[model samples]
Target: MPRFISKSLKKVGSSPGTLIHVGEIKTEQSSLSMLHFDAETHIEQPLTDIGEATSLLTPDATTWINVVGIQDIALIEDIGRHYHIHPLTLEDILNTTQRPKVESFDDYLFIVIKMLEHDKEKDSIVSEQLSLVLGKTVLISFQEDEGDVFNPVRERIRKGKGRIRSAGCDYLAYALIDAIVDNYFVILENVGQRLEAVEEAIDSDLDADILEKIHTIRRELIYLRKQVWPIREIITYLQKDGAPLIGEATGPFLRDVYDHTIQVIDTIESLRDMLSGMQDLYLSIISNRMNEVMKVLTIIATIFIPLSFIAGIYGMNFNHMPELTWRWGYPAVWLLIIGIVAMMIVFFRRKKWI
Candidate 1:
């Protein structure tokens, strides 16, 4: 089955705000981590129990709660209850197939986006749903798996490298989003390299495998576009809607992320166009090859037509046939056939048909 289609049959009859997990269980066990940081202080620790989330929340500092897995329904519900996150929002968090979007609530901003990575070994893109709940002093991030592209953001927060340490939870959220967007460029670069390789293969060798490669890349781009296109709107909403959870200072950064989204979308479109053109070029090349073969066969059959007719006329059983009694009949017929073939070859060459 195509990876783009999510199996949601389990949710067909379920009520809204149901916490049923809809996608693959990428992680075996769910884990939680809390990072509390301010300008001069930074504290990071893993939480063994959900009850510890309340004790770890520092009212004076910004808290980032990272949930590594979402398969645990009770854990998600506990977090939601503690943070006062909407049940619908929690449902979106558990359902990995949620579209990239941002919802503004009275207490928090619910944002869902796909974190994409290019798997080098598989030569394909792997996606995981990342849901962020940005509140006044705390930001909760829920992921389908443990690994993510947010390591650089974590490094910056830990090292106090930039204004992030001095910023609010909104800015921290922006930093995380920025990291995800920036990694998109890396993924695109990898895709561009793949496209270059495919193009070179198309030009140098018309292997049947090249078509499959083009289709694979094309499908990946389409899936990427679906995952990314809505992000533009999400950023636009964050920047322009002036959500209470999104600070005014973070607007420009969201705009920057919006620009990156545009670039990603444009690159996706350009690559898709290239794939379409390559597909057409491949089919045309195959058609021309087939035409060449048919032309050769047609010419051969044309050359043999007269020879077959001549031989057939002399092949009659009539004893009075003049050619059968002639001494040079077979040789004369051979010469005539050769002359006709040569003439046809010259004619075809003049017409540029061979």
Candidate 2:
């Protein structure tokens, strides 16, 4: 079985809110970029230093600071210094295995969620932890790697194609969250396709290998559920908790996200049930094939029984066998045996047992 929670042994002896990297090392170095925009003006800048990024982050306009990698402990500490981000929230951000959740701080909202995609090369699900910090006029995002499921959102914000430009930081946060949620649908669709392929394979080839595939799909669904199930509560808190960090305009959008989360939960459950049924069906196919073999063997054995009996009597060394001494006895016995076999075959055919 694959490990569900990534090993975080680096955090074994650390303090409760220590900023130790706890996931895979995906990149060589971290990169920071900022997109500051509002109704009429927009600024795009690549940041090399946290101080510069902090200086640019003001309430004058909506800003989005995207940190591509979080393995550098120093960088996380620097951001914490400027934002007054709680140590615990930073801890969760570094721990990629943390479950999806939302929390409100003094001046910001901390959101942790999973970004998942199916890797065709690995034939498995790949997951990453995405942490979002929503403030009054700024939204900071932390990712494990550069480029993400947010490219479409970036395109929208750049073209001013939607309300994202005229919206506050909260709406920008909503757009990001919506993009992530929409990705779930894509991943689930891929899973559904794989299920269909496996289901077809089960019908044509019932073997141990198919059993292994079933187990694999089951594991994938289990992990997906772990990531998605918590999202319901995460969004529920935003929609109902009345968090000041989440704008009133964003409430309806978060509610829509919550509804989508429920749909994802339902899809995961239905797929799980389908996989269970598939396992049972595999067992049934194997059992039925075994029964077929046994039935054929029994029929062949039954047909030879009378022939063996006749041969045994004739081969006995006693002279009291009348049929053995008769001139036509040999041919007569042959005829009788052949007649018996013919009759038995007809009987079996009529009974549909042949």
Root-mean-square deviation of candidate 1: 1.4
Q: Kindly report which residue stretches of model 1 are placed more than 4 angstroms away from their true locations once superposed.
A: none
* Candidate 2 C-alpha error for residue 73, in Å: 0.6
Give the per-residue Cα lDDT of candidate 2 at 345. Answer: 94
lDDT of each: 0.88, 0.86
With candidate 2 superimposed using the best TM-score fit, by how many Å does residue 10's alpha carbon deviate from the native? Answer: 2.8
Query: In model 2, what is the error at residue 58, expressed in angstroms?
Result: 2.6
Model 1's number of clashes is 0
Q: Write the per-residue lDDT of candidate 2 for residues 88-171, one digit (tens) a residue.
A: 988998888887888888889999988887788998888888999888888889999866898888888788887888878988
Query: Compared with the true structure, what per-residue lDDT tens digits does model 1 show for residues 254-323?
Result: 8888888899899889888988998898899889989999999999998889889977887777988787
Tell me each candidate's RMSD, in Å, in order: 1.4, 2.1
TM-score of each: 0.96, 0.92
Give the least accurate 10-residue stretch of model 2, judged by summed lDDT.
1-10
Model 2 regions lying over 4 Å from their true place? 203-208
